[model samples]
Structure formats: C-alpha cells, structure tokens
Target: MRNNRAAPPWAHRWALPAMVLVTVFFVAPFLLNVRFAFSSWTSFRAEITWNGLENFGTLIDQDLLANAVTVTVLYAVLCMAIQNTVSLSLALALQRTSRINTIFRSAFFLPTLISPLAAGYIWRGLLAPDGAVNSFLGIEWAWLGEPSTALLVVAFIDAWKWSGLITLVYIAGLNSIPRSLLESATVDGAGPWTRFRRVVFPMLAPALTFNVAVTLVGALSAYDVIAATTGGGPGDHTRALNVVMRQQWGQGFFGSASALGFTVTLLVIATAVPLVWWLRRREVAG
Candidate 1:
C-alpha cells in the first residue's frame, strides 16, 4: 500500500520571488518597449500618441537603420571570429593541468572580471596617438581616429575581454573528451593537428555551439566598449545598433530609440534561432 501527499506550500513558494522579479524587470520592460515602438514618445512631447510604423519609416528614410545594421553585423562577425580563434588557441595551449597553466588562466581571466566600460577606457588611453602603445612601438598613430581600423581595433578589444571565459569553456569541453580516444589516435600515428581535426574538434561540438552563439549575441548587443573607446566616432564607422539607439534617445526621439531596440531584439532572435538550429544539427552530425 502507498500513501500520497502534496508538497508543502513553502516548497513551491521558493520560485515565486524569481518569477516576480522576471515579470517586473524583464517582461514588463519588454512589453513597454513594444508599445513605445508603435507610439510617438519623445522628450519634446507631453503625450505619447500612436504613430504606427512612422518611427521605422523615418529611420529607413534617413538610412540610419541600414548603416546601423551593417555596422552591427560586421562588428558581431569580427568579434565572433577573433574571440573564438583566440579562445581555442588558449584552450589548446593550456589544456594540460599545471601550476603555470593555472597562473596563466587566472591572469587571462582577470580581464573578464573588469567592467567593459572600464576596459574600453583603459584601451582608449593605451591606443591614443601619443599613448603607451605608440610610445612602446616608437611610432605615433591615432588608433581610434582612423575609420578603417577603429572598428577592427574595438572588435579586437571586445574579443580580448571575453576570450578568457570562452577559453575556460573550451578547456572544460576538452577535458570531457575520453582520454582513451586521444591515446588511440596517437597509437594510430595521428599527428596533433590531425588528431584535433579528426577527433577533438568533432567532440567539442557542444562547446563550440555555446561559445559561438554567446559570443555572437554579446557582440551584436555591444555598446559600452564601443562607447568608452570610440563613442561610435570616426564618422560612425563603429556605430552599433545600440549606439544609434542611445544617440536617438539623447536627441529626444524616444519612440525611435524604442523601435531601434525592438529591431535589435528581432535581429538577435532571427539570427540566433537559425544559427543555434544549424549548430545543433552540426552537433548531431558530429
């Protein structure tokens, strides 16, 4: 014979605070943003009147939306590529456990703990025309003032800031692989590169999926680093979608800013959904 009893009320109440916080903070703001995106809310106006699609139309006419989209995609792509490359290299190099590797991992991860804005400001100072970087190289160049190089430089810095975390993820993935698999490959006379390409790489599909998706989304939503470093300057060469939204907000175009934010949300969803699906498929295939 068995007896059944429902859980205590307190047992289910544990999640209530988290649910309330999520509704109040994330869900509420998102709904409000959607509503504002369809209205005419601005600092110059006392009333927020419905103006369906007007804000988006105006942005489209001005070509600001296209430019922001292009810049944002470019920046995201560059960051994803650079961060993953650096991270994978570091993970491979430090996969072996040792005191030196531990020290190096800690040192690399220290940058991840710093505020993005603060890191940008630090990089700003270092990349100035007469800054330490130029002095050390014995040459002067305005790193942040050049249109062609500013975006890439900012992307590299963003990658530098996050590579540590991604490296740790890769290291975790590497350690999870069966040691016998690597040893078998070695006995089969497979070289390091061949082993990685044929065995280790395929086994790391899940980690690659997580790292790539995260890095792409983070880069798409990047603002603080670009703001502190270039402020979307050098003629808007590095102006991400968020930077453009901030500019719109500053210019008393609240509805337009909200529309831009909504667009960013849409872009992220659209991009990430397909990418994650494709990555998951690749994981299965691997």
Candidate 2:
C-alpha cells in the first residue's frame, strides 16, 4: 500500500513575501529615482520638470564629481583594508573558546551596537585639538580638521565601528573547520604557519568574500558617521560620493543629485559584480 497525497507545489516559494517587500520598499523607489534623475526640482515648493540629460551634463563641467570619485574610492579601499585586517587578526586570536576569550569577545563587539552617530561624535571628541588623543600624544593640531589626516581618520573610524562584525564572520568560519583535519596536519608534523596557510586560510575563503563585499558596499555609502564627525571637511577633503550627493541636495540640486546617485549606484554595481564573481571563483578553486 502506497500514500496517495501529492507533494506540495514549489512554484511559489516562501521567498515571495520577501521579494514583494523588496519590490515595494527598494525596487520601486530605485525606479522612481531613475525617473526623477532626468527631471529638475529646487525644493518641495516647486514642480519637477523634465530637463533631459542636462543634469548629467552638469556633472562633467565641474571638478567636484571627479574629486568625489577619487576621495570615495580611496576612503572605501582604506576602510575595507583596515577592517578586514583587524577583524581577521582578532578572529584568529579569539578562535579558542575560554572564559577570558568570551569576555574579550563581548568587549570587542560592543562597538557594533553603538549608533554610528554616537560613535562618530565620541571619536570626534577624542580626536579634537584639545581632546584625549591630542592630550595623550602631546600634540596641538586638530586631527579631524586637517586636510592631510581627516579622510584617513574618518576611514579608520568607520573601520573601527564595523570590524567587530567581520570578526564574528571569521570566527564562524574558523570554528567550522574539522578538528580531524587539524589533527591530521599535526600528525604530518606541520607547523602552525604551514598548517594555517595550507588548510585554514583556504577554508576561510567564503568568509573573506563575504567580509569584502559587505564592507566595500558599506564604505561606499557611508554618510551619518562622516556627517557627525567631519561633515565633508576640512574643505571637501573627506567627502565620499554619498556625502557629495547630500551636499547637492542641501544646495537644492535635486535632479542633479539624483543623477549623481544613479551614477554611484552604477559604479557600485560595476565594481561589486566583477569582484564578487572573482571571489566566488576563488572559493571554488580554494
């Protein structure tokens, strides 16, 4: 005797609800931006008028957009580098579970829970001319008010805030390695460096890919932290693409801002697609 009930249909999976939510909240708004990118608006007081490609044309007439590209790319790259290095090192150090390790893990990850605005303000205070950092170092210069150091300091601050997240990601990857594999390597008389290089690093490829992708995207879109700390100063030295978009908005260039944002979205997509594809290939090869 056999059961007669048919299996459930898989045409409409449970992901449909999430897809619908994204369509409503994200995709719709993105399409709206595309539509508005070709139109002009000064403020809420004025009607949006179609201006063809004039908004994009204005982007080419000025050096602001070019400078923004350089600043944004540099800042984002620094953030990705600092965060990944700190997080991976922390993960390797914290791999062994112990009472002390648990306490330290909690302490390190505490920054992630702090609001970006609050973290930015706190660092701003610490980096002030007369603040704790300068007081401790016996310097009179303003770290966040100088063109030479402001952008790097801002990137470092962003890295500090998010490193804990990638630490956790790396920890999960580290913990997933089988003890048997490590034991086999030990039996082969492999030293720690050799064992890690040959076995552990290869296995952690997925975590690396994930950390890189998320951090790159986050750094490119950084806003609130920069807003609270440097506000795109000193003299636009720390302005990322998003901060530049905000400046355009503040100056009542809504249509041009939309075009700028659209350009940024295309840039991120262009960057992420290739990088992610390469990482996925590396995962397979590893």
Candidate 3:
C-alpha cells in the first residue's frame, strides 16, 4: 500500500529553504501584527496593554467607520465598473496590430507608469479652481473642494490612472483568440457585435477575472493618492478604508487601525472570491 514516487531533486533541495524564508519574513510578521491588533497602547504610543474587544468596541462607536465603509464600497465599485468597461472597449478597438494601435497603446498605458502620489498631485492641480482643467473648460467648479464631488473625483482619478493596465490585460486576452474562429463566425453571417458577444466577450473571462481582482485590490489599497490629494477630506467625504486606517494610525490608535486593515483584507478576499468564481464559470460555460 506504500508505493511511492521519488520527488524531484530540485524540489527537495529548495522546499525547505523556501519554507524557512516564508516563515521568517511573512508568517512571523503577520502573527506579530495580529497580536498588535488585539493589544492596546497608552499615552502617545508609549506603553502596550492587552485589551479584549475594546478596540472593536471603539471602532463601532466611531461613526467614521460607517462612512468610510460606504465611501470605500462606492469608490471600489466605480473603479471596477468604469475601468473594466472602458478598458475592454479600448482593447477591442485596438486589438489589431498597427503603428496607430501601437502608439495609442503606449499613450494609454503611460498613466499606469506614473506613481500614485504623482498622479494624485497631478489631478489635485488639475482640479483646482485656477488649474488647467478649469482654464480649458471656462468653468470654475471646485472639483476637490466640495464633499458632493470630492469622492467622485478621487474615484475617477483612480480609474483613469489604472484603466490602462486593465486595457492591456484585455488586449492580451483578445490577442489569444484564434483568427480562424472569428473568420468562421464572419463567414457564418455573424455581425461584429454578435461575434463579440458570442465569442470575444466570453473568452475574455480570464482577463476580466484578473483585471477585476487587481483593480479591486488596488482600489481598496488606495492611500498615497488620498494622502496627496484630499488627505481624507473635503471633510472625510472621500475617505476610503485605507485612508481611515492611516488617519487612525496617525492619531495613535494602532489597534483600531490594525482591526480596520484586517477587515479590509477580509472584504477584499470575499469580493474577489465571488468575482473570480463567477467569471471563471462564465469562461467554462461559454
């Protein structure tokens, strides 16, 4: 009953080292942070005290958490929707290889190369009253100065910066489809829209899964952009969960911030699991 196949030599050689590295770098620190999440601090980051549900209780009492959750959900949803749609559309438009397509592809992808901090600052200036956007439009609406528009503005900026990467992912997916299948569809009297609907869209599920997951993670992890642009204002209207965590950390609420971070991690995992599963099912079904 004990028939055994020998493992590869490389696996035996490297597995222990890899496990050791992971435990040292990731597992150890993660356990330490989990400990921090349940522990309390006194004075200005002075002394540590173990507290049972006190931090969670504090988070519940802080009404900002509710606002942060709402804003973060809205922000993540908008980013996911707008970025995925625009990117997929653009990828479809530029699927074929050509000089024009190449040029546009580079241009579209340029924004993703910029640091988020720089992008935030760039958008901040553009949204200012006397900035280029207002100057070009001949209107003086303060984009980041009002709670009504600030969250939307930040969400849009986040989408604009990241959609290029999503587009490229979609393009890769599009490129993977065989020309023969598309030609056959055309020969069989399939219109452009019909072919895309029946063939292109379904096959792009992998890209959709990847893009959705990445953008969801990116949108949730948004911090430097908010820090540089709004600093969780127009009166905390644009404050995402990560921004709230950072602010909490700054105010020396380490346990509360850790709890918020853990919540965010759980939320991302929950959303991503369902999304990836749904898209993958579509792939198989299609």
Candidate 4:
C-alpha cells in the first residue's frame, strides 16, 4: 500500500525558525551590505545616497583595493600550499591505527581546538625580538618586524592552526580506501612510493578537493590570527582584504568598507567556483 500522505505540519515546523533566523541574520545583512556598497554613507553624513560605483573608484584610486587583493592572494596561496603539505604528511604518518599514532594525532590536533587569536598571541610572543624562538635558535631576528618575512610568518601560523583538521580529513579519505587494493598492489611488487603515487594519491581526489577549497577560501577570509599576530603590521605588508575593510569601517567609511566586503565576496565566488569545478573534474577523472 503506497500511502502518499503529505508531511505533517509539525514535522517541518522547526524549519520555519531556522529560515527566519537565516533571513534576519545572513540574508538581510548581505542584502544591506550590497545596498550600502553603492551608496555614499559615511560618518560625516547620515543620508545614504546612491553614488553608483564611486566607492569602488575611490578604493581603486587609493590603491588600497589592489594592495589588499595582492596580499590576500599571496597569503591564501602560501597558506594553502603549506597547510596541504603538512596535513598530507601528517595524515600519511598517522595513517596506522596504533596507540602511538593515536597519541600523536591527539597532540597535533590540540592546536586546532585552541582559539586562533590565542594561538596568534602566543606565536606573537614567541616570534618577538627576544622571545622563545630566538632563544632556541640563538639568533635575535625580528620575525614579525621584517616586511619580507612577516607575511610569510603570519601565513605559516594560519596554516599551522588549521593543518590538524585538514589532516583528519585526509586520514578519513585514506582509511576509506579498500585494503584489498593496497594488498593487491603489494602482491604485484609495486613499491610503497609507486603504489601511493599511482593508487592512493589518485583515490584521494575528493578529499583533496574539499581540503584545498576549504583551506584556500578560509585563508582568503583570514582575520583572527593575523589580527592577533601582526594587526597587519610592518607597514601593511600582511594586511589582508578583511583587515583593510576593518580599517575603512573603523574610519567610518561605511560605503567604501561595504564595497570592499562586496569585492571580497565576489572574489571568493569567482575563485572558488572555477577551482571547485576543475577539482571536481579531476575527481571524476581520478
């Protein structure tokens, strides 16, 4: 008997509150941000008059937009590369389900649980001119003070913070591969490196896609660690787009700030869409 009865009203009642919350919080704020991006709202004035693309023009003229975009892209790329490399290595090292491996995994993952700001602050002290790092290395180098290395240092910190989570994802993907395939490859006289390169690595495409997309996007929008570490210091060398938006907002350039936010959103969508599409194709091919 195929009883095609509609779902009861209470069965779906909870969704209403969730939808309302999304509308009130995410959707509404996003729409308002778009509205303000094209306006002339500032601390100097109350009336928000539409000025077309003037806010964007102002930002472009100031070179703030270009600088922020460049810094953000470089930071994101560095973080993505570092994080994936570290995470993949960790995943491989901890692939076996042994007591030692378990303990080490837990130890490594503890950092992921810590607040980013706290991590940044801790690293800031450690990387200070006369801090633990310098003490250990016996070289009193200013890690966060140098324009050349400050951005890289901050990017490394961000990558370190999130590598554990990405490692677990890779571990999960590795574990999902059937043992039969590995055993078959072993019997066929395939070496460890060859088997991994030809079999294991290709099989991890889905995980790779997820980890790469997430790390890249998250780095693009990074703020907390950088804020606590450098505050976009060394003469705005490490200033991400979000930090630039915050500076504008602090100075009461609401419209310009909103324009920056909108630009970030567009950039994320632009980068992520194509990246994901290409990654998905690789997954299929793999």
Q: How much lDDT does candidate 1 score?
A: 0.93
Candidate with better TM-score, 1 vs 4: 4
Tens-digit per-residue lDDT, 1-286, candidate 2? 7754764576358668989999999999899888778888767747888889888778668667777778888888999999999999999999889999888899999989888888899999999999999888898888899999998889989999988888999999999988899899999999999899988998888898899988987788888789999999998898877888888899888888888788778778977999899999988998
**Highest TM-score, which number?**
4
Report clash pairs, candidate 2. none
Every model's TM-score = 0.93, 0.90, 0.91, 0.94
Taking the tens digit of each residue's C-alpha lDDT, what string does model 4 give over 248-271?
A: 999999999999899888878988
Instruction: Give the local distance difference test score of model 3.
Output: 0.84
RMSD of each: 2.4, 3.1, 2.5, 1.9
Total backbone clashes of candidate 1, pairs 3 or more residues apart or in separate chains:
0
Best by the lDDT measure: 1
lDDT for each residue of candidate 1 in 189-271, tens digit (9 for 90 to 100): 99999999999999999999999999999899989899899999888899889999999999999999999999889889988
TM-score of 2: 0.90
Between candidates 3 and 4, name the one with more favorable TM-score: 4
User: Can you give the lDDT of residue 81 in candidate 1?
Assistant: 99
